[model samples]
Structures are given as C-alpha cells and as structure tokens.
Target: MATELTAPPGVRVDAPAIQRRTVRLLFVTQIISGIGVTIGISVGALLARSIAGTAVSGLTQAASVVGGALLAVPVTRVMTAYGRRPGLVLGYLAGAVGGLFVVLAAVRGWVPLLFAGMLLFGGSTTANLQARYTAVDLADPARRARQLGLIVWATTVGSVAAPNFAAAADATTRRAGLPEYAGPFGFSAAAFVLAAVLLFVLLRPDPLLTARRFAAPTGAPDAAVARTPQAGAPVGADAQLPVGADAELPVGADAELPVGADAEAGGPGPARRAGLLDGLRAVRSRPDARLGVTAVAIGHVAMVAVMTMTPVRIGESHAEADVLRLVGLVLSLHIAGMYALSPVIGWLTDRTGRRPVILGAVMVLLAACAVAGTAGHHTPRLAVGLALLGLGWSGTMVAGSTLLSESVPVDLRPAAQGLSDLIMGLAGASAGAASGFVVQFAGYPVLTALAAVAVVPLLALALRPVPAGAAGAR
Candidate 1:
C-alpha cells in the first residue's frame, strides 16, 4: 500500500483525506454558487435593457467582470495571509450583498444601482473561480487536472438548471410584489448566503494552509512564507518547478517535471509581501507560465465577447412573445455545453497534453464563431454554435488553469494565480464592455469574427516550442 503523506513538526495529516474533503466541500459550494451567478447572467442584460438601453446592456456583465478582477486583489491577499476558507467565505457574502443590491436596483429602475449590485454579485464568481485553485492545493501531481476538472464539472448541475428557472423565478418574484426581473437576483442572494455559511462551517483546516505545511521540510521552520523570489536568485528556466503529467499546460505551462530534484532550488525563497506586480513578474519570468496567462486571458475575452451579446442578438432577430423564455432556454443549453463535458476536457488535458487540447479548443472556438455569426434568427444553429462556444471555453479554462497552477512553485502559486485571474477578469471585462458597442454598430456577426481574431495569438503561442525545464511542458 502506498504510504500516506503527512505534514511536519509532529503534526500528522492524511493528505489524501484532506484533499478529498476539500474537493467535496468545494464541489458543493460550486453547485450552490453556480446557481447564484448563472441566474443573474440569464437575465441581467435584459433587465438592463428594460431600465437603460441596448448600448449599455452589456455593462452589467462588464461590471461583474470588473468587480471580480478588482476583488481578486484583496481576496488573493487574504488567502495569502489567512487561508482559503476565510477568503472564500468573504467573497460569497459580498456576492450575496450584491445580489440584494441588484434586486433593489430592479425595483427602483436604477441603472447605476443595478451595475453596483452586479459588481458585488461578481464576488460569487470570484469565489467560484478561486475554488478551482483551492482543489489543487494538496492534489497529487498526476491527477491534478482531473481533480480540478471535477470541481468545474460539479457546477454543471446548478448552472445548467438555473437558466430554465428564469420564468419561475420571475413568477415567484411577481407574486412577492417585486419586479419579475428581480426574482433571480433575490433568490441568488439567498443562494450565495448558503454557500458562504457552508464554507465557514465545514471547510476545516484550510486546503491552502495545509498544503503549505505539507510542502515544508519535515522539521523546517513554518512554511507560511510569502511567495517572492529570493534576491540574486535566478527566476528563469533553471528555477522551474517540475510537475508529473502527460500533456503540457495549454499554451504556456510546461508538462515536463524533472522528478527527485528539490522543488525549491532557485525558486521562491523567504517570506515577503507578494504584491500584484510581484505576481505578474513571477508569471512573466517563466515562459510556460506567461503562455498560460495568455491562453487564459485570450480565451476568456473571446468567450465573454461572444456570449454577452448573444441574448441581444436572439431577442432582436426573433419577434416571438416568449423571447425571454427562449433566451433562458438557449442560455441553459450554452451553459450545459460549457460545464457538462469538463471532466472529459480535464482527462484529455491529462491524456493528450495541454498544448494539443488548447489548440483544439482554439479551432472549436473559431468554428463556434463562424456558425453563430451566420445563424442569425436560426434558433437551432445559434444554439449549436453557443454550445460549441461553451465547450471550447471549458477546454481552455481547464487546461490553462491547470498549467498555471503547476508552473509555479507551491509557495508562489497563489500570487501567480491571482495575477492570472486578475488579467483574465480584465480581459473579459474589456470584451463585455466592448461587445455592446461592437454589436450596436458592426453587428453580432462582426463581434463574433472579432472574438475569433482575439484567440489567434494564443494559438500561435501554444504552437511555439517549450523552454527547457518549464513545468508541465512535456
């Protein structure tokens, strides 16, 4: 039987058990929180259109993306200082508050209030995104992608189901003496609260803190150090941390791990404040990591640019009275595509390699754009195209995220991850904000084509040769 790994200083722990417990808790959290976020997404734009105008409809999603990106700074710092549990709990509660604000905004027909609420609502997404990172805190290197994918896959149940409930949520709120559009946000607020309480009560010992303890030498001083590279130490290729895996990280992450070498050799050293710039530098210093960020950012931007404008396209093209219901159904199908096959995407990342999968994802994205661009009022083709778009996003997100996590040394992982997410959020925000204007002028087909263009750079980067000693680069 394989020996169970334990932390040092006479404090023993079954790493596998902790990991399992962590995954389960996070999975449940994802489901509950997923419903909260997706419910808002299904109707946020339409709600904005009711109060504001078509040009500003996309601002709701943009605000959420911006909120998530900006929030990542403090959340990452909290996780760095305290641990995952506190940070995650904080994020969820903030999202719940945001949901309340959104409900109030709808009641008052206030666009500014709606945007503010949407920003706060973004906190739920931040927590959900960060949870994936938490899952890998103590994961076996060999199965890291699969474990990460599982948490993402768990989101399918809630995300796919939430959109279908749009009409029900609307009716429920109408009966409650509230605006129909306000129901989803109100229900979402309750969901976020539930998720926060669950983490606060059950997420014991903290995955990140435990992982740090396990990574430390058996009797070495507390490894709760900040993840800054040592002064005068090399932060280049020679400092690469190895990860055992089959495929390289999507675009920039290395798939190759030189086992048996000290992971800390020339890597991040003694504790220091790992500021955002430091995190950015860490990713920049590593070729594979840099590429991973590129993949994540571009893929996110492309997905957001297309998805945010889709409802408007459908509503404009179809004059049906049940347009809202149609929007809800279509979004449900799109979300299903995004999350339903995550495990398979994760497994493929492990089996086929990150680069191949990412490249394939790029192709899939391009195809989605092409199909949707020409689909116009053709509901079936649009649905198929949106589904493909979701599938492509899943591939990039899983593979790119896994690569980002494994590329850096454990100590530096949080900082690097924070930087990556921040960039990704910003990229998505830009796309969301611009999508409105683009579609307003150039049309939806033009927007899809532009989104497709944005990902070409990532594809080119993924095809480039890996640098020597890059982690997860096979």
Candidate 2:
C-alpha cells in the first residue's frame, strides 16, 4: 500500500528521492535541448551571413539574445504562478516556432524573416541555459553548486555531437528538399517538440511543489503520530514517526532551500512577493546579489562580444565547406570549454570561493583575447583562444549564478533569476550589436581588445575586499 503522508494535505513525502528523479528527468530534457540548440547554432550565423551582409550577421544572434532577454521576466513570472515545467515547455515551443520562421526566411530569401526566426530561436537558448536551475531547486545548500554544475555538464553530452551532426543535418536537406541551413532548424524544431513531450509525460509530481509542502511547518496530518520503534534513523533524516504520519523538518533549514529560498511561509507568514519592481528591490536590497548579478552580466557581455564575430572572421578566407568545418570545430571546442569542466568549477566554487573564480575568469578572458587578437589567421591558435573563452565563461557563469541564487530568499528567486538573466541578455545583445560594427570599422583585433576591456568591472569587483556575510560562502 502507498504510505499516506501524515503531513498536512499539501505536504509531500520523499523529497530527496523525488529530487533525484527530477534531476534525472531534467538531465534527459537538457540533452535533447542541447542538441536542438547547438544544431541551430551551428547553422544560424552562417545562414544569416549568406542571406544578409556580413555586417549584419552578428545581428542574427544579437536579435535572439534580445528576444531571450525580453522573455526572462515573462518566463519567470509563469514559473512563479505555475511551476518550472510549464515555463520550460513554453520556452521550447517558442523555439520550435522560431525554427519554422528561420526555414521560411531561408526559403524566401527574406532578411527580416530570418532575424525574426532567430529572435524567437533565442527561446531555445533560454530554456537550455535555465535547465541548470531546475537541478538545484531542491538541492542541499552545501552541494548546490556541484549539483548545478553536474546538470550543466550533462548538456556537454549532446552539445559536443551537435556541430559534428551538421553533416547529418545537411544530408537532411537533401531528403527534406529544403535550403541547406534550414535543415538544421528542421532538426531543431523536431527535437524541441520531443523534449516538450517527454517533460509533459514524465516529469510527474513536480519537485518544486513537493519541496514547498515539505518546507511548510504549520499544518498537521489528519492522523495522530504513531511512535513506532523502528531501526535507527539516519542523522538529519526526518524524525521517526508512524509509517503514515507526517514528517516535520527541524527548527531551521539545515540545507539549501530550492532556488536559494529559505522556506515558503506555509502558515500566516509573509505573502509571496513577485513582479518586476519587487525583484529589482530584492536584488538591490542585498549587496551580494547586486555584485553577483553584475559578475554574471559582465561575463556574458565579454563572451558574446568575442564569440559572435568569430565565424565571420575565419570565413572570410575559407571555402564554404572549409568555413563550416573549421567554424564547427572551433565552435565545438569553445562550447566544450564552456560546460565540460563545470563539475570541477562547481566544486571549486565551494572549495575556493566565488571571488577567486571570478578573478580567474578575467585572467583567462584576457589571455583568450591576446591569443586570438595576435594570431592573425592561425586556425590552431584561434581554436585554442576560443576554447579558453569558453572555459573562462564557464567559471564566471557557474560561480556567479551560484552566488546569486544563494544570496536571495527562496520566494524571490524566480524574479531574481529573471532579473539577472535579463541583465545578462541585454549585455550580450548590446555586445553582439556593437561587435559587427567594431569588426567592420576597427577590425577583429580591436573587437577582441574591447572584449578584454569588458572584463575590467568584473575583475575590479572580484578584487574588492569582501566583508563578513559576503556572497562568497559556499
């Protein structure tokens, strides 16, 4: 017989077990999303370059960045009202729609339509990026960063294969009788639909809801607690009670709350605070959160600024196949650097500190700029430079996100993440927009120098003296 949870009607059972299941489901979901996203990425800029002038190719991804940034608040708001499931599903669906638009644009040779498709396609990237947050929604504070990083690392499984699959996608063009680049978007659309379906069917007993019920302390189960003398309970495990009796948490939170919240006010506690303005105040109220957001936003600007123009730079000299192959190789390496070592990055965030990692990211980005800027057209050196860019981006991203999540109250976290991601999106969008103009006028070397300069604020902040109760704590 199913053990009836003796806790209040709303309370849930087996949170740790449920969280594990949630992570597994999310991992599968992320792999599919990774494939969908990278497939589009492999072709997106290149297609835009062909359809429009190279000057505007950067605008393709830039438009997507803007779209994703714009959706942040709305997506998070949906999560707040319903749950992570609905929000993620919506994001993927939007991406699917965007993919169709891209195909339409390619078929018609319409620049506007391609930009439109890419902008909405940004939703896929948004979903891919946000998947990491789901893993830690019910994570223990001590192990939160590690778990988040592990989920990010999972994306590497599908993402690594994505660029290589460009050939497969190209072959798909022959079968589908579509434009060459549109083949990848066709693949992208199908993958997003499959991912959405899997999540809808399998992500049962949502983890965030269950976690809230467990955290709420006020209500009692209908039945009385049966004091059964069972085998010794594990330390910090739920108190031993009747088999069906509701289990209560200790006086305070021993581990991290889902999404960095402490605990939901189950009883007559403070009502949930939401909305754009409230989120801004919540962030501004906390010094650590402010700094964390700044780090994340600046890191994104540097990464995107350098990354957006890379295909254009190398493709100027190579044949179509060579350009795609080399760009694919370089991109795969850069993306690999972004997520492959996140488990270590997460562990180090816990072991060392956020500030140190932030500082390290600055140094790596500086090195990447130097290598790529001076290499002229050396493919090997450029590849290495891009990979370092990914590595440096990974460090700041994981560490900065962990710190931001940890610093905020649980109830306010959705809004906080929305706010931070919005800022990140805007920064990336701005850098991307300026990137083409810079490469056109000042040259790629100056563009790289600009990216290097973008790291200044982050480095300066990291080097500042941290006070007690700083956001650096694991």
Candidate 3:
C-alpha cells in the first residue's frame, strides 16, 4: 500500500510514505499542543474568577470560544493560500503569544487583557481542530476516518495529563513569583511555540498538495485540470455549482472524486482569497457537504452545553477536595471517551456508513442527557453520563469531519472546514452562555434537555436521503 503511491508524473517522491511520516509528526506535535490547549481551557475560568472576580468569570470561556470562531477565517485563508503548515504554525504561535499576554494580564490585574489573551489563546483550539483535517488530507480515502481518529486519540494522552500540571503550574508560579495561574499559561506558551517549530520543520511536502497529486487518475489527458483554487486562489465560473437548500448531489454516493472535482484540477478558478462566507457558500451548494457541516456544529453545541456545566453541578454538593478529584476523574474519562475510542468509531464510519455513525451519536447524546440530566449529586450516574457524552461527541466529530472533507472539492475544503469550525465554536459559545442560566433557573435536567433538543435538527438532516452522486453522501 505504501509503495503503490509512488510519484505521479512531475512528482518523483513517495507521497503516501511521506503522508504517513507527516501523520506521525503531527501525532507527536498534537500531544504537546493538546496539553497546551487543555491547560488554558482548564484554568481559564479559575483565572477569570481570580482577576475579574466571580461576577463575570462565566464569560471567560465564551470569549475564548468567540475568539476561536473569529480566527478561523484568517487561519483558513492562510491555509488556502500557503498550505496547512503555515496556517497551523501561525495558529499555535498566536496561541503561544496569547499565553504570554494572559500572563501579563495576571500581573497587571487587568481583566480585559485577560479576556483578550484568552481569546487569542483560543488559537490553540483552532490549531487542534485544523490538525484533524490535515490528518485526512493525504490519507487513503477508505482509511480517512481512521487516520483522523488516530490524531484525535493521540490528544487523549496529553489531555489526561493536563490537570496534573496544576501542581507544576503552581510550582512555576512560585519559582517565577508570578500569579498563581500564570505558570500554566507560561508552560502552554512554550508548548505552542514548539509545536509551531515542529510543523515548520517537519511537515514537509504539504499533504494537501500531495493528495492532489494522488487524486488525479492514472492516464487522463486533462486529469491535471484544476477544480478548486489553491489556498488563496479563486474558483473558475465554469467549475462552480450552486449549493444550498437546493443543493445538488456531488457525483455519486461515496464516489472517488476526480482530481479536479475537489480542487486538484491544476488550473486555478477565481482570483480572490477564500473567506468564511465563501466557505459557507461552497458547502451550502452541496447537500452532503451541508450535512457534514451541520452535524459537526450541532454536535459541538450539544457537548459544550452539558460538559461545561457538569463540573458546576458537582461543585454544588461535593467538598472542595472531593470536587477537585472527582471532577478530574470524570473529565478525564469524558475526554478519553472523546478520543481514546475514536479509532473504532472511524472504522465504523468506514464500514457502517456515515449516517449510521451520526444517528448513533444522536442516540448516545440522548442517553447521556437522560442520565446526566437527573443524576445531580449522584457520582456514578453522572460519571457514566459524561463519558457517554464524550463518546457521542466523538462519533459525530469523526463521521462528520470525514464527510465534510470528502463531500467538498479541495478549493473549497479549507474555507468549508474553517466555516465548520467557526460555526461549531459559535454554537459552543452559545451553549456555554446559555447553560449557566438554564441550569440555575430550570435545573440541570433542563440544561440536558436543551442539549438533547439541539441535536434534533442534525438528526433530521442526517435522515434525509443522500444523493447517489455525492461522494460519501450516505
């Protein structure tokens, strides 16, 4: 399988083998970046409370999510023009810089700066999300989900270790004599920087470009025609198709896209840089693409709404020490479920069909909501529920992401992916903003009920018939 992917025409290198190496490199980089992202996310609320005081602490996460959503535009634009390496490297670097600013905010007791930094700090989140797409870029179509899953699974290692860094973070604070929360952010900054360096140095040949080469058929005369624009280029009018509620099916169900179909046409389309609106417009034109984007966005909304509040529910009853330990254990299991078992989900997506996996995710989310909604102070019930919630999220993530990548043509891929993440971040932010009120007013069950209900649209969308011509439509 590895050797079969020898260079096509102009290229003489082993693209598949290089892709494998890139995956491995990204895997290791994600471990470090994952830790960086987790440390910031874990401590953001606490730091907000410490600086801004408890009154507005809740908005810290919302700000971070918003920042991440907004950054997807510029980040993907860069990727569309340059390549994954530049976009990813820039994201981590921005996050690393954000960490430093947060440290400054802590020192000056500036709450606004703290939010600003946390917002920029969300670049790590963007990088992490984008990295999943990169994993599938040069991947074998049949094995696409599996490759993405492995990267997702790799993050579990660092995430599970992140909370433990509180001690280390504290130690750094003492040694540096900075704010109590400053140490972890400092450590996160370093991780982000290192990740950037690795991507710059090691992610050679650019997987997306390599995949384009592989996508061209063996002997078609005009196989090298360009379908999508390169990172910054525009699509041609003739190659364009309208996408929306009136969306057309791709080519055929799960069809192996011709090189030009997804942007490997070798010829450029329009002359402008792609942006968020462009991405949304592209996905909207294709039915299957719309489903993929919808699934990812709604799935994220469901997960964040409940997961963000679970700790608060536990903190409501448990002692400080018990709450810390219990939350750690529960969150660990949840994060693990989100990633550790992803390979199996990917395999299932490949084997059972994307729609089944999506429906399964919805079912799991429903079950998670049912258990978590009423569990309240009960330990076992809540733990299992949170874990299931993570699994459910993973199911949607893997399947939906794969579908999104495959359904769209390459020129649109970056923008489409960026749009997917932007919507997802916004959805998560909305959920985070609303969860607190819902829980405080109507109770945790109400919050879970809302989360469950949020997925109804996704479920309905998935149930719609996929067009036979759409690649991976089912």
Candidate 4:
C-alpha cells in the first residue's frame, strides 16, 4: 500500500515545460511593459502640472487610483477566463489607446481630457501588478515567493531607465515644437504596443493553464505502491516514501492498512481551492496579516501623498527644467528602493518573522515624514526623506506581499492580490488629493504631520503578538 500511494503534492511535483516557457516569455514582456508604464508615470504629473496648473495636479494622481480600483475586478475576471496572456495583451492595448489620448490632450492643451487619458492609460498598471502572479503560477509553494520576487526585481531594469526616457522625451518635445509632454506619451504608446505584440505572440500554453493541468488527477490506483526494501534503505524511509520504483506496495486486500498506521501512508492530499472569501477569512483570522496589511495600506497612503506632491512643490520653488530633473532623480531612487530589497525582504520574512520588518518599516516612514515636515523646502532633506520613504515602502511591500501570498491558496491568489492592491490604490488616491488640498491650504508640514500620525496604529498592530494557533501556521 505504501508504494501504490501517490507522492506528496509538493515533494515530487515538477514544473511543466510550457509553464517554464511561459515564465520566460512573460518575464520579457513584463520588462518591456514596465518601460512603458514607467514612461507614463514619470511624465504624468509633469503633464498635469503643465496643462492643468497647480490647482488640479492631484486629479492626475487620482485618475490612476480610480482606474485601478474600478478595473481590479474586471481584470481579475479576464485573467480567470481568458488566461494571463490574453489579459495582458488586452491590457497593453488599452494602455496604448490611453497613451494616444494623453498625447492628443497634451497637443490640444485639454486638462479634463488629459485626466481622462491618464485614467485610461493607468489601467495598464493593473495588468502590470498581475504580472507577478503569472510568474508564480506553476511554482512550488516553497519557491513561489522567490519567483514573485525575481519578477519584481526584473522590473528594476525598466524602472531605472524610465526617468532617462522621460528626460529624453522632454528634450525631443522642445526640439520638435510639440507640447512639453507629448514625446513621453508617444514613446509610451509605442512601448505598450510592442509589449502587447510580444505577449500575444510568444506566451504559449499559459502558465496558469499548465498548473491546472498538472494538478488534475490521473485516475491511477489509490493504494500506495511501496518499493521492495533494498539492502540499504534511507533512515527516513519510515517517514517518507522512496522515489520511483523503489517503494512498490501490494494491491487490493494487502493494501488495506489501519487508519493512522504510518505518517507517510496517505497518497497526495486534495488540492486546496482557496476562494475569495477564504482569502478574506484567512486575513481576518491571522493577526500577522492584519498588521501587515494595515502597515502597507497606511504606509502607501503616506508615501503616495508625499511623493505625488514633491515635483509640484519643487517646481514651485525652482526652475521647471531643474525641477523636472530633480523629480526624475527622486522617482528613480524611489523605484530602486521599492524593488531592490525584495529578495532580502523575502528571506527576512522566511527567517526573522514578518512583524519585526513591518514594524521597522513603519518607524522609518515616521522618521521620513518628520524629516519631510521640517525640511522647510530644503531639497537635500526632501531627497533624504524620499529615499528613506522608498526604503520603508520596500520593506512594507515585500513583507505584506509575502504575508498575503501565504494566506491564500493558489487559486485565489490573483483575486485576493487584486483586492489588496485596489484598496491600497483607493487609500493612496484619497490621501494624495487630500494632501494637495492640505498643502495648498495649510502647509507641507501639516500634511506630513497627518501622515506621521496615521502610522501610529500601524506600529501598534505590528508589535502585537499573534495567537498561539496563528503563530504555529507562520
């Protein structure tokens, strides 16, 4: 009976060839898509400031958040039905169209239309966010977090180049007598179109589909097929079945073993089908998840609120050219901070526990906020604060994402992640717009103070102990 039993799900499962190919293709496509996304985001606020002026700059940031929130469900449904390839292709197409509209808006100097275009263009970011899940679609549970982290790190290449691309676009616009932001949007459109083509043409058999196929039962015998004990059997043979033909077990009546007879007697267990509600329940039940989510959500709110306004504030104080360069530098540093530490963060989560990293991130962000508040328009202080903010964001995001990954089963991962991202986007948008109003009406110091205050509860939650059962799961 021990030989007839199927191997444990994770112990012997091998990734399908198609799944490997899909991961490679998606990695390439995502890198290109990242470039397009970076271009759009790098230039978006500048475009808004140029066209809509200081009063409605927040609307640009708000458009992206609203688009992400609105499209989260639909995007998840697309990935569910058509698979990741088509969903990604369609998303890039939408982004291309949106980029065109942005260019037109810039050429015509239409603020509302530009905002609309930004909303549309920003929908692609939703697709980009989903890209990490695609990387882990067929990965083993032990390697899933690492695979996700690798894909995220891949985006660093594009993100690092994005500011330079935006700068080039800005220069091109001046030389061509076009609107200041037209070149970036045009370049972004081309990049999206290219990525869409690559995804449609190269991503074959889809990683998600491959995972589903591998998980299905083959209708083989239910009894464990135990191998003949050789002259030398490993000591752990009692605990684990031998690989291949070594552990053939008897069939029929001989296979009938007493229940709970041996630790390794059972065949592969049923696959876990975690649904959306299941993920939510996991989050609700896990104190660690709750604290991690709170830290991420609040930290994101503060980060976006301050980051969104930095360029505009700098522009108000310095020349447009100098301010744009400064904005580009800050954004580059921010992206570096966001993605560069993901692998290390994942390792830390696996080793040191999620709470310490999360709490430390919140403390760093609090310090950043305080620094930003007291900088009194000092560029160096602002730069330092922004860099720290990026570091804090990285820690929180990696820890939060790792926590979320563990909470949901493979099936529900995409939807649950979408929901989490959607909520983050909503909070970020609201805070960003409110920060603008606060900065305009009150001052940057007041805005930063409010963000610092919001971090307090997150810190408390991060420090709280998990229940005994919950701790066991971690």
**lDDT of each candidate versus the true structure:** 0.76, 0.72, 0.77, 0.65
TM-score of each: 0.81, 0.81, 0.85, 0.75
Winner by lDDT: 3
Tens digits of lDDT, candidate 1, 308-386: 8888898896777878778877777788888888988988988888788889999999999999999988988998999
Which regions of candidate 4 deviate over 4 angstroms?
Answer: 1-13, 16-23, 45-58, 106-113, 140-143, 167-180, 210-282, 285-292, 312-328, 471-473
Candidate 2 vs candidate 3: the TM-score winner is 3
Sort the predicted structures by lDDT, highest score first: 3, 1, 2, 4
* Two-way TM-score contest, 1 vs 3, winner: 3
lDDT of 2: 0.72
Give the lDDT of residue 50 in candidate 2: 77
Off by over 4 Å in 3: 1-10, 213-272
Give the per-residue lDDT of model 4 (tens digit) for 336-436: 67788776766665566567778778888998888877887688888888888877877777677666644443344555666667777788888887887
RMSD in angstroms between candidate 2 and the native structure over all alpha carbons: 7.1
